[model samples]
Target chain A: MIILHHLNNSRSQRILWMLEELELPYEIKRYERDSKTMLAPPSLRQVHPLGKSPIISDGEVTMAESGAIIEYLGQKYGDGRLIPETGSADYRQYIYWMHYAEGSLMPPLLLRLVFEAIKSKPLPFFIKPVARKIADETTRQFIAPQIKTHFDYVEKFLGEHEWMAGHKLTGADIQMSFPLEASVARGVADSYPNITAYVKRFQERPAYQRALQAGGDYDYA
Target chain B: MIILHHLNNSRSQRILWMLEELELPYEIKRYERDSKTMLAPPSLRQVHPLGKSPIISDGEVTMAESGAIIEYLGQKYGDGRLIPETGSADYRQYIYWMHYAEGSLMPPLLLRLVFEAIKSKPLPFFIKPVARKIADETTRQFIAPQIKTHFDYVEKFLGEHEWMAGHKLTGADIQMSFPLEASVARGVADSYPNITAYVKRFQERPAYQRALQAGGDYDYA
Candidate 1:
């Protein structure tokens, strides 16, 4: 039996969504983030050394990294539905979006989160303004611009195709779901209708709704 | 003909290495990073909207993201040499490493670089120490520990397997090359002999040498 090591409100939600979409039988071993730290609890380290979510164990095989898990499920259980045919143009785009979601898109979004957290941390009266200035300047000069570029690129792509890869729903969409959801939560998605619309379409799917029921509260959507 | 849109000392070097390993004929259109901004030149934006290095074009297909590019090359040109056989445990491990390299590993390394840059930038005498404190605290509290965890995890994996995916030098190693190289350049690889040794093994390969000769100056080695 396949067992997903899921964490609340984390990237693990996408795995649950993919599992639902594939109609696979899997058990979720739910983990909660620490209330104060907002980090995956230390107990999760028992499942995967990285203590990361969306990890799954099928018999003896234990895997981490959402893209890898998504690809694995698509290959082993997908019956050729989640991925495009090998050597096709859609296959290339499929590969690009799957990797791009985490490799390119998530990094800046993560940095933005970190900067915001840093900005909010209580500081001495004298140091507060300096800290805020650094955070704001970094956002303006570095973080925000990169996020905008990525969103712009995605918007342009979605404008052309209904889905990330091409005309069909594939693992690319599942892999991309979390980052885009987080973007919507950040309010950046308001300016990019294509992205917001894509997220809305995803939310409207019955399988996605089922995943939401299986997985716990995810406020990003 | 396959064209690699390479930038000096960037992730694109891995594509050249993979091309050499596969013995595929490919041309390079090299772009230089801006000296001051340290960002990819605008010329590359024409090739891919993200303007990131390691974008490759074969005929009409233009692709970005190193993991995706590595997989494409492995699938289309590998002749079953660089990637493990499908449905095998090694193949699963192969996919995990390919995605983990960029998805899990590179982000912290990139943030460390950015933080270091922020720490070094000229600032007003009064604000200099405050900026340094924030950078230092972030590194100590957040960045360095995560990096150590990643390095420890990699060291353990290399201790068990000669290559990233079992015993063979698959594209997993190619995908992982840049981050490990950056680790060495950061002076962090010394404590992790397995990582340093793995990198040494990689650097000693004739294909890697050929890639260096063709791709020009790479200081990480």
Candidate 2:
């Protein structure tokens, strides 16, 4: 059986959802964040060196990185589901989103989170305003605009195609779900109707709902 | 013809390297970053919506994201080169590094660049110290440590395997070349002999050298 070394409130939740979508029999080995630091527990490193969440082990194969895991499982067990036929335009889009989710999209969103934390985290009163200013300026000047550009690009794409890879739901959408969900949850994507509806449409899936149950305490959902 | 919408000092340089590795005929349409802002030229959006570097157009297909472009070329043109066979452990490693390069690795490195910029950028005299403090603390506390963790992880991995995907040099190494090069060029990996050697090993490749000539002004190389 495959074991997802799951971590709370991380990308692993989406992996769980993917497994559910494949209807694969799997087990979840839950790991929680350090409540204070919000970092993945050190024990998680045993699975993969960097200790990032969503590491999965099946027999001798242990993998980290959501895109790799998704592609691995899709190839191994998907049986023509959740994957576009290779060489099609949809396949190209699938590969693009698979990389773009973490490569392009998540970085800015992660920066937004880091900067927001900088704004709110308690600091010496003298330094507080300066820190807030720095965070605000960085967000306003750098992070926010980039995020808007990406969200706008995605919103327009979703408007044209029902799914990230096209009309049919593919692993690209599964790969894309977390970042878009986080966008919706953070209120940054409130104006993006297509994105919000995309999130809602996926969340309403019985498989997604089941994955939520199997996983626990996901704030983004 | 595969026309790489090349951008100076950006990820597209690796796409050029991949093209050379495959010995494919390709054209480079160069875009330079803004001298002051250091962002990709606005005109790149003509090729892809995100306007990010490394967009490529071959006939009807126009694609963005380095991993996608590399995979597309490897599958369509590689003809049993760079990519590993399906279901093999080497293939798994290839996928991991493909995603890990941009997905797992680049974000913190990017944050380091942003914070480093924050430290050095001209600011109001009164606010300079506090801004520096914020940048320093963030780097010391978050960005630097994360980068270290990753570099160390990679160093250990490289110690065990000659290439990212095992004994053979694969597309994973090409996918990984830029950030590792950036790490070395920035002097962070001066102490990481394996990484430095890894970068050096690939840089000396005839294809990589050819790529440098074709794609001008790549700082990381």
Candidate 3:
């Protein structure tokens, strides 16, 4: 049996959604991140040296990264189901979105969270302005365009189509679902009406509900 | 026929090496990074809105992002030659390394670059102390581990095995080749005898020679 180590309000929820969509039998081990730091607990490092959430220990194979996890699960569990074979056009696009979610997308999300942390904290006066400036530049290079251009692209994508890819509901949508939700959780997309409506649509699906329930900790705020 | 819009000493060289590994025919439209700022050439935007490296135009399909490009090439040109089939264990490991190269490894590289930039830049005396502190902390979180822990893992693995997976060459090795080379270029791994030897092994390959020749600005120093 596959054992998914899950955490609330983390990318791990996407894994649960994926497992649910595939109807794959799996066990969930819940992990709650600390309230203040919002980091996956240190105990996680024992599971994998990376100490990240949404990891899986399937018999002998222990893979950690979420993008890797989704790709692995899609291959191992959803062979005839969630993911299309590599030869298909959708598979090509699927890999793009799968990598894009983390590679192209998450760096800015991480920088934003770090900037927010610096802002919220009572810091020594000497370094705060420099920190803010670096954060601003990071925003210019990665964050601003990501939300404006990429989010607009996603909104346009969700506008004409119900899913991220083809007519079938594949893991790509589930792969992207949490980050879009986190953008909401972070107030990053407060003004994008299409995305707001799209998130609502995603929330209405029973599979989404089942995914959250199975995940054990995801609150979907 | 494929057209690769490439820049010298950039991540695009990885794409070049993979093309050599597959012996795929291609043309390179080269651009030099601006001497003043050392940024990727402005011509990149013409390839994609994001203005990134390793954008390939195969007929009408234009793709950006390095990992996506490698996977695309593997599926489209090499078929099951460079990467494994989608459901195989080799395929799963291939996907992990694909994500690992960018998701886990590259961020530290860029972060370390950022710190070096902050340190070496001409700045006011008042700001240097705080700047040093920030650089030190960021380096702790993002930079130091890639060389010490990450490359150590790579060093040991290469010592124990002939390739990244099984006994055969795959795209994962191709993906890893650039980073290991880059780490050497960055002076990150002298202490690890095995990684140093592995780097020498990969660098001496005929395909690597072809890639360096095709690249024109062969600065894989």
Candidate 4:
């Protein structure tokens, strides 16, 4: 049996969706982010020392990192379902989107979150404008352009293919979901119709709806 | 023929090392970062719209993301060399380290670089101290602690195994090389002897030397 250590509204949701899609039997041990910090609770460290979510344990094997988990689940229980066959062109594309979701796409989005948090932190009235200026400038100069580039690249891919990797809805789409959902939450979705449509299609899945119900509240969608 | 589109002192160097280790015939197309911005040159966008390093083209396959490229090369050329056999404990561990290198490890390190750059930027004299305070505070409160956790985790793993996955030096180690090397360059290596030793072990290898000679001017080692 697979035990998913899930954090509500985090990347863990992607794994839950995958389990549902793959029809794998699994149990979820839910975690909640601290309301103030919006960070995962220390309770998660017991599951894995990294204290991050989207970790799973199957028998003696426990693992962390969403892409790793996605790949492992896809390989083990997927029975060749959500991933393209090895040595195929679609397989190469699948690997790119799966890794790209976390490797390249999430960094700038995460920085934007951190900067926004910094800007909203309680500060002396006098220094508030200066902090705001720095945060806004960093977002404008560094984060926004990179985010645009990534989304544009993703949009172009979605324009050509029904799914991220190719014609099939695979683990790449599941892995890519979080960043794109977060992008929608950040109000950048309107500019990219294909991405918006992609997210919509995922949400419309009965399996996805089941995962959402099981995974708990996710404001991003 | 395999073509590696390398950027100086970037993650792309990891691919060069992999190519050498696999004993594959490959050519390098090196792109220098802009002297002022220290970002990948616009020329890279011509290869892939993401304009990132560590991209490669094998025949018609053009791909980016280090983990993806590592997995692709490992599957296509490895012949069960740099990666473990499928459905094994080692393979699961291999996947974790490969994705964790970029997904979890690189983000904090990259943030540290960005914050340092922001702190050093030419700003009005009066605002400079404020900027430094912000950067230092973010480093102290957020980035530094996370980085320490990651290093601690890596150290624990290396303490157990010679390589990232198991007894073998697999593509997982190759994927992990960049972040560990960057940690050393940033002067954090002293805190984690295992990681330092791991980097040293890889550096001593002939393939690594060959990669360094071909890749050019990586100060991290």
Candidate 5:
């Protein structure tokens, strides 16, 4: 049996959407992040030592990391359905976007997040001003443009075809949709109209709606 | 035929080693990072816009990202030699280690680099002493122990087992060896004897030497 340990308003929304896309019946084990601190609670460590989200168990094997989980599921349960078989051009493109989503696309956005939170401290400590400068400079000077550019790149790629990978919906779309949506949620998506339109199409999918029902209140807040 | 677009003293070292481990004949097109800035030169952007190293072109397909390239090579040429066949426990473990090398293990160390670079910069006018306090406090309080703790995890894991993927030297070893040697080169390995021993074992391999020769100065710095 496949089991998904999900966290609401977090990356697990992608996993849920993936499960729906695969039409794979699975069990959901939900956890909530600390509201005031916006941190994952210590109780999550009991699920896995890493104390992170979107962990899955298949048979007896359990693992953390969202990218790994998405890759594993595509390999294990939905090989024919969600993943492309190896060696074909389609398969190559599938694998490329799979890695691209986490590898090339995410670092700057995440660094931007950490860069911002460290600056949110009300009192200007010895470290506060520097943190604020890095975040402020980064968001305006580097990160915002980069995120918009990557989103535009994705939009142009999508224009050439339908889905992120190809004509069919593959796991790459499933994996990428969450982060793309989260960017919109954080208001960064407003600058990329192409991404906004693409995301709207993503929302219209019944599978996406089903995932939201299972996963709970998720939106650009 | 395999073609590697490489640069000296970069991640290309690992890719070259991988080709050697597979005993595949390949051509290297090399680039040098800017001596002044120590960043990959803009010339690399001609190959891929990311301006990163360790890209491989096998026939018509070109791939970037070290983790992706390693997996691609393992799947293509080193199937029996490096990675396990698809749908096996060995294959599953191989995937885990591949992701772990670049994702979980490398991030924290890289984060330290970012923090240090922040400190290395001249403190802005009026905030100099505070920045020093933050940098000093961070180095003593967090970075040192966090690094030690991470390496210790590797040391203990390696101490009990012959290799990272347990009993055998699979592609996981090749994937992780760069970072392990890197930790050593960066002065993080001295504290972990078993990790040092493991690095020695890796260095003793003839194939590793060929890869190092191909990579020029990189060969684990």
Candidate 6:
């Protein structure tokens, strides 16, 4: 049996959906974010030292990091179901998106979030404008363009391939689901039709709906 | 032939090291970062849409993202030399480090860089203190502790294993080499003996030395 250490409203939701898609029997141990800080609770540290979620333990083996866990689950339980065959061209693309999601894509999005928070964070009245200016300038000059570059790249990819890897659904699609969904939920992806539709197409999956029910109150869904 | 789009002082150096380790014939197409902005040159955009470093092309396939490319090179040229056997416990750890290097680790380090720049960035005399304060507070409140948490976790792991995955040098070690080296180069990792020694251990490799010569002027080494 697989035990997923799930954090509400985080990337862990994708793990649940992956489990559902694989039809694997798993139990979800939920952790909530600190309401004020929006950081994962300290209790998660007991599960994995970093305390970030989407960790899974099967028997004696424990794992963290979504891309790794997704690959693990796909290999251990998937029996070659959720991933493309190794050494195929699509397999190459599969590996690319799996790493690209959190590696290449999320950093700028995370930076954008940090700067937006800095822009609005309550400060001494005199310091407010200065802080906003710094945040706005950084966002305009760097963060925003980096994001646009990524989105445009993803949009172009999706325009050609039905899924991230190829014609079939693979773990890369599951791996990519959270970031794409979050972009839509955050209202920044309305203009990218392929991305918006890609999110919708994944959401409409029966397995996705079941995972949503199991995960509970996911913000990005 | 593999052609690496090498970028100065960037993660692409790891790809060069991996190529040398495999003893494969390859070519390097170096792209210098803009001296002022420290961003990859526009020429890179022609290779990968996002214009990121460490992109590689073999035959007709061009791939981006370090972890993905590392996996690709290992699979294509390694003949089972650089990775653990699939589905083993060590292989699981190998995959974990591959993603964790860039996915979990680099973001906080990158954030620290951003905030450090914000603190030192030239600003109006009136606003400098306020911008610095915001940057300082965020570093104190969030980024610093996050980096510490990740480094501490890595330190504990390295204490137990000679290599990142197990006793042998796998692609995971190659994947993790950049961030660990950069942390040392940036002067934040000296306190962690295991990390420092691990960086030294790999740097002493003949393949790594050859990579240094081929790479030309790597800061992290």
User: What's the TM-score of each model vs. the native?
Assistant: 0.98, 0.98, 0.89, 0.98, 0.90, 0.98
User: Highest DockQ: which candidate?
Assistant: 6
Q: Write the per-residue lDDT of candidate 6 for residues B1-221, one digit (tens) a residue.
A: 88999998888999999999999999999999999988899999999888889999999999999999999999988898889999998899999999999899999999998999987888888888888889999999989999999999999988988998878899999999988999998789989999999999999999999999999988777
lDDT of 4 by residue, B83-139 (tens): 998888889889998889889999999889889988999999888888888899989
| Worst ten in a row by lDDT for model 4 chain B | B182-191
Scored by lDDT, model 5 comes in at 0.75
lDDT of 6 at B90: 87
Tens digit of lDDT per residue, candidate 6, span A101-204?
Answer: 99988999999999998888888888888888899999999899989999999999889889988787899999898788999999989999999999999999
Q: What is every candidate's C-alpha DockQ against the true complex, given to 2 decimals?
A: 0.88, 0.88, 0.55, 0.85, 0.41, 0.91
Native-structure RMSD, model 5: 2.8
Q: Write model 1 residue lDDT over A70-186, tens digit each, in one string.
A: 999999998979899988888988999899998999999988988898899988988889988998999999999999999999999888889887687999999999999888877
- By DockQ, the better pick of 1 and 6 is 6
User: Cα miss at A105, model 4 (Å)?
Assistant: 0.6
Across B137-210, the per-residue lDDT of candidate 1 in tens digits comes to 99899999999999999999889889988777999999999999878876978899999999999999999999
| CAPRI category for model 4 | high
- Provide backbone clash counts, one per model: 0, 0, 0, 0, 1, 0
Residue B13 miss distance in model 2 (angstroms) = 0.6
Residue B193 accuracy (lDDT) in model 6: 97
- With a 3 Å backbone cut-off (N, CA, C), the pairs that clash in candidate 4 are none
Number of clashes found in candidate 4: 0
Interface RMSD for candidates 1 onward, in order? 0.8, 0.8, 2.3, 0.9, 2.6, 0.7
How big is the RMSD of model 6?
1.0
Clashing pairs in 2: none
**Rank ordering of all candidates by lDDT, starting from the highest:** 6, 2, 1, 4, 3, 5
lDDT of 4 by residue, A11-94 (tens): 899999999999889999989999988899999999899999989989998989999999999998888799998888888889
Residue B66 lDDT in candidate 6: 91
Clashes of 3: 0
Q: How is the predicted docking of candidate 5 categorized under the CAPRI scheme? A: acceptable
